[model samples]
Target: SVVTEMTGLGAHTLRGYERAGLLQPARTAGGMRLYSPRDVAIVRRAAALAAEGINVTGIRRILQLEAEVALIRAEFDGVPQPVVAASAERGASGTG
Candidate 1:
């Protein structure tokens, strides 16, 4: 599958990802998995995070926060940019 090619993960690993709640691919009438672009991105990111020594639980937390940040950024994209940089700096400094 395209996802396997994109992420270097096998079919078994992909199914494990689905079971882990890291991927939400669509299903065909015959129960075939069809991965969307977002699923592909998540798989790639998960693989990268795993390669970087992050365990599955930590990767889940990071991915969840990243999605939340994207949503917040999109919501604020039309308005004048806020002072989120300071907030991000604080987060990086472990003071948030």
Candidate 2:
């Protein structure tokens, strides 16, 4: 697959990542796994983390946390800076 070729990971390793709940590639009607761009990015990141000696469990957690942070940032994207600063100040002062 292009993903395996691009990431330098084997099909077996990709299946292992799916089994480990680290990836959720889409499937075709015939049940072939389809790796989207996001899936490919995740595979690359997971391979890098593994090369850094992080286990699957740690990789999953880090990915989840990074996703959460991205979500939070997206949610804040359109808000005014003053509003964000005020909200932060209120939370800091325990008055939010």
lDDT of 1 at 92: 98
User: RMSD in angstroms, all models?
Assistant: 5.3, 1.9
Error of 2 at 46 (Å): 0.6
lDDT per residue (tens digit) for residues 6-72 in model 1: 8889998889778888878999999999988888889889989988999888888999999999998
Q: Which prediction has the highest TM-score against the true structure?
A: 2
Model 2, CA-based lDDT? 0.94
C-alpha TM-score for every candidate: 0.77, 0.86
Error of 1 at 37 (Å): 1.1
1-96, model 2: which lDDT tens digit per residue? Answer: 788789999999999999999889989999999998988999999999999999999999999999999999998997999999999999999999
User: What's model 1's TM-score?
Assistant: 0.77
Clashing pairs in 1: none
As for candidate 2, its clashing pairs are: none
Candidate 1, run of 10 with poorest lDDT? 78-87
* lDDT, model 2, position 33: 98
